[model samples]
Target chain A: MIELCKVTAAYQEQSILENCSLQVSSGEHIALMGASGVGKTTFLKLIAGILPPISGTVHVSAERISYLFQEPRLLPWLTAAENVNLVLSDSEKTIDEAHHWLEVVGLAGAMGKYPDALSGGMRQRVSLARALAYGGDLFLMDEPMAALDDTLISQLLSLLHQYTQGKTMIFVTHSLEQAKIISDKIYLIKNKTLELL
Target chain B: MNRRWLKQVLAMLFWLGLWWGMAVAVQRPILLPSPAAVFLRLTDFIGQPDFWVIVSSSIWHIMLGILCAVILGSILAVLTAQFPLLDLMLSPLLTTVKSTPVASFILLVLVWIGRDSVPSIISGLMVLPVVWSNISTGIRNVDAQLIEMAALYRLRPYVMLRRLYFPSVMPYFLSALKISIGIGWKAGIAAEVLTVPANTIGKMIYESKLYLETTDLFAWTLVVVCISLFIEKIIIAALGRLDIQHGRKVAASDD
Candidate 1:
């Protein structure tokens, strides 16, 4: 379960998400939809605790949170497999787990390849694999599927439905079809506020 | 086949041809030695035990100075990057060292320190600022998003330094090292010449200059160039190997 009570986050003096409140029970999938520059990404950053809200109380049942940024943000110097391995904690099991995740994301054969060699969709899949590899209770994705084609997006959505239904996920995206496909609940976010749609 | 080696050979031949022509125009071995004269002098010097002693001594001091500079400069760079106030305080000192003439430093060190220590001190001082500035920039310019990811993941300090900071800094550090080693060799040799240290390459060059042994001077200069080039190649090759090793480790970890 996660709750953002009267959150007010801003950059400099300008507010992006102002006095916004949201709550998601455990195992709930919520999609936050909004137009461009409407704080959709900002909200995820706040929830992920990367940015502190100026005025708010965020309560999370779980301490660990996995966030997938809009960009893959994979280290260019690291191979795709290494990027996935970076998140795992267990030394003895990390390699096996990384391999498992890579296979899960259909990147099994390209483990030795660097990020530059991979296509956009493949890089995003690697990022998704990294996030999933972390195995956090609350998953926060900030428009992770924005770069993929419709076919890849549908495949990713289906994968998301299989792996994340039993876990709490707050997905922020602009695609209404995607929201309808995977989200148990969709919130029409606008003007630094959310209206349940 | 690599064109790089061919280009280098051609360039060397062109310069040698020009030098030969200039020597011919001068028409006096005492004034300027031809390529053949320098080569013969080089062969004679190579056969002398004393020449080897001088070359080895100068190389030892220069290499030691470079080692000291690399260690201290890298440490200082890391410290200053962590503390802005320290960086601010140290910036002027680095600038002063950088701006001060090599001859000035060599002369000053001669008066204040032993003749043997002057070249080493001068060489170390010459390399310090180059290393500091380059490494500092490298640290500052590390990918912010990767750092954020590391922070978010709670990566251990050792892992973060090894995996992130070192790789990011390697390229900058190598560039600085190449520049510093080249400059340090020149400054170190110059210091030796000025100080006239016994059993050193600079002393040989000084003796040759004083006696108008132009061929010997050219030969010693060739030796210095050869040594510097050799060291630079070794350093670059070692850095390349390290890069490959780092890449392999990262990949292996993923598997």
Candidate 2:
């Protein structure tokens, strides 16, 4: 469940989101579509409690949150599996869990490989694996499938659909097809406010 | 064997030959002892029981100083990075410490602590500023995006440290250790030479100089160099093992 009543977010003098309001019930998957520099990432950040609203209020009623950033943001020092394991608890089981997620993301062979050794798509999948391994009720993803091809994106989307069942999600993307596939409702950012389509 | 190894061996032999020629020309053992004489003196030292004791004692004192400096420097770096006021206050003091001569610190510490403790304290003082500056910069330079991801996941404090902070700061920490170890060890020995602590290599060097035993002085100085190199190799080996175990193969694959 999420709620935002007239949330005005800004970075110093530059306003990203102005007096924007939105509400989503539990288990709702919402897609946010916006042009470049249009604050789609800012909206996700606001919901994930990364950025504070300059003037209004935002609330997210979730026990845990998993965020997939635009960039992979994987720890370069950690191997692909180790990067996923970073979000998991320290246990033998967690190692297996990390491996499982990496496998699900089609990175079974790359489990021992470092981020630097992996391609851009592979790295992004590793980041996705990490987010999925975290196992959160609320998922905030910013263009998570941007690096993958259409076939891979479809496969991953199906996997995501199964994993995120009954979980609340706020996905940001430019692809209308992806927006339709992953989200129950679609909202576009226009003129500094969320416009439902 | 290989080209590089052959080149290195040749270079070493060339230096040794030049040193032998100079000693033969001088023929004054008091001013500059022959290489063979110094080597024989070192062999005699190696056979003595007192040599190991002296070597171990110096190692203990300098290592203790280095360890203390590492711990305290890391803590201070974290604290200063967290609090701007603390950073403002510590900036000038650390800069002063960095710029101050090793002999100055030795003298100042001599007035406060006993002769035996002077080496440890002086070495710690010598190392602290470098460790602090490097680690503070590392902390400040951690990738912001990774930090945001860590926060979003609500990672435990210790987990965050082990996973995020440690890896991010490791290169800087290792660089600080490499630089500061040499500086600290040299400074510690200098302190010992001044203080003339009992049963130390520094004390033996001083006594050798006082008695005009040039061969003994050269032998003791060689011991110092050998030990410094040995310690550095051991540390680098240990850190390399840690890096391997942690899967930090970035440096190797960086090229």
Candidate 3:
């Protein structure tokens, strides 16, 4: 579903990745594991069409992509349900889908609450619900569950697997256990390069 | 009412009590009218048809000015935010407007436009820079990560504005309104006073001063202050309601 050939990216004078390459087949789940600030997010951004590589080609076959940011990034004025519904094209089905996703995320009671009224974990779940309600073939998540608790994490891991079944997903995480649970293949970001594991 | 609003009301009453004490000490209605005297004068003024005509005209002109300024300023802000070159070109001109004295503009405007239009024009001019700058700042302050996500999802422009920009920019816009409305009132009245337009509070004030009716002058001044405070309180209350809806304080500086 995605390919990056000899990608070279930088932030001003400093290089984040050099001579890096990655490829993902259709419906394959991939995890990029790394320490803090190792450009895992950058690589994901490259595939997600947010960051253009300095000197490489990135190709994404999937036309529809849903992204969950590290921060919840919910609109402060929007209700939790509205936040999810915003991702969908206007339809009666969108409202039902948004409600369903909120229910799946354990926020059925919070549909009317704005992001400001939500706790951190609840906001993150709202973000996750937004991504899921979007109904895309490609999913890119950057440390999406970082703010979640262990119980919530396990619940979401199961939901993520169910929702992302037969879809291409690229996620970044710090935990090996999380990577193993979600990803069919794992890659570590280190020394300004992606190392297959 | 909130505690903060109650506290502000109490503070104003304390100052008013001091003013009443000072008026008692002076023991002269001409030099300094007592609060009761001013209140009585205000009641009489309110009952007059001429006073209503003047107040209503002033309200219409100033509100029109502010509306025009807000519309033009928001358009300018969006243009400037979208284009750096426009921002670069307009920065100095806006800064000049900000830095120049209000009296200077009023004088020049009085020459160009008639006295009837001066108050409205000056009020609009005074308000333009405030709305433009604050809205531009709000646009610049939008979160980068959210933009990235927005791009990845391919949100439509109107949807992007509704879902992102409105929430982010509303507080800044309200803060700009809170500040610029006062400036508009001040500039509008100053223009009216200088031009001596008919059916205006400023004209009444100018006439009272010319005839040495110090009590009337004090009364007019008190009316202006009261009206300004009332309008400001209403705007701030509406803004507070918006803050409650959005779930975040504006974080705008009071000044």
lDDT of candidates 1 onward, in order: 0.87, 0.90, 0.86
DockQ scores of the candidates: 0.36, 0.49, 0.40
Worst 10 residues of 1 chain B by lDDT: B246-255
Residue pair clashes in candidate 2? none
Error of 1 at B211 (Å): 1.2
lDDT against true structure, model 2: 0.90
**Residue-wise C-alpha lDDT for candidate 1, range B88-148, written one tens digit per residue:** 9999999999998888899889999989998889899999999999999999999998898
Please report how far candidate 2 places residue B100 from its true position, in Å: 0.8
**What root-mean-square deviation over C-alphas does model 2 reach?**
2.6
Per-residue lDDT over B46-150 for candidate 2, one digit per residue giving the tens place of the 0 to 100 score:
999999999999999998999999999999999999999999999999999999888888888888877999999988988999999999999999999888888
Q: Give the higher-DockQ candidate: 1 or 2.
A: 2
> For candidate 1, lDDT tens digit of each residue in A1-197?
88999999986667998788888999999999999887887787787777899998877786667788888988777777778887785244587889899898888998878887788889999999988888878888889998899888988899888888689999888889998988889997777788899
Q: Is the docking of candidate 3 incorrect, acceptable, medium or high quality?
A: acceptable
Per prediction, the TM-score for chain B is: 0.95, 0.92, 0.91
Model 2 CA lDDT for position A59: 86
Q: What is candidate 1's TM-score against the reference?
A: 0.95
RMSD (Å) per prediction: 2.5, 2.6, 3.6
